[model samples]
Target: MEAENKKLDQFTKEVIQDAGLATPSVDFLANVMAEVSKEKVPVKVYKPLINKVGWLIIGTLFLIFSFVLTRFSLGFSILGDWDLSSLMLEKHEINVDIPITYAYCFFFLLIFVIIQITMISKRFSRSLEN
Candidate 1:
């Protein structure tokens, strides 16, 4: 027990000495407390009508943004076709604009994202109802 006590005392003393070496001035702590005390508490802004309108605008923007993005992305294949021409698999120039593959992929991803968001929204709405 005495040996353990001596080891613990030595460790504690070492930690204290190390901490003391890195200690900030008392004035720094005083200034920090003063600054904290001078700061104002943040106010929560609430306007039910404005909030509803804001959300409507945001929802509209998201829908339009998704529509435009999907439209462009579906047309992405025309910019540059992947060079599958190296091997004896037959060199072919792909015209992306008429291709249905990009359209299919775009629709699939959009559907998946919409379904996931709908599920989450539904779950939250259900919880709110309960």
Candidate 2:
């Protein structure tokens, strides 16, 4: 049996050698590389929701608000005796009594939100690949 198997293997090898190996075109490597290079991989551009101009506007508004709040607090009205009482909330009337259970619930909610965001991002990325 062993002699027969050896003879068969030798015959198969001889036949394969006589069949000759396939030869690629002269510029096969170059052509493949060129094709690979030509392939367009979609790229996601990074664009902030708030641009520099938007940030500048927001910062200017914040500064203006701070200035107004400061002047109003010190009895120095920038609006010339304009009642700024509406802008300032009365501290005495405000009473908040939140339960510890609410804090735990909010904490759990935050964890769930973070997990969901990660899962959603991964799913979107995988979908884009296909």
| Worst-scoring 10-residue span by lDDT in model 2 | 83-92
The lDDT of each candidate is 0.72, 0.84
What is the Å distance of residue 83 in model 1 from its true position?
37
Candidate 2 residue lDDT tens string, 3-122: 999999999999999999999999999999999999998876546799999999999999998767744565666688766555555633777988999999999999999999999988
Clashing pairs in 2: none
Our model 1 lands, by Cα RMSD against the true structure, at: 17.5
Model 2's alpha-carbon lDDT is: 0.84
Candidate 2 local Cα displacement, residue 57, angstroms? 2.3
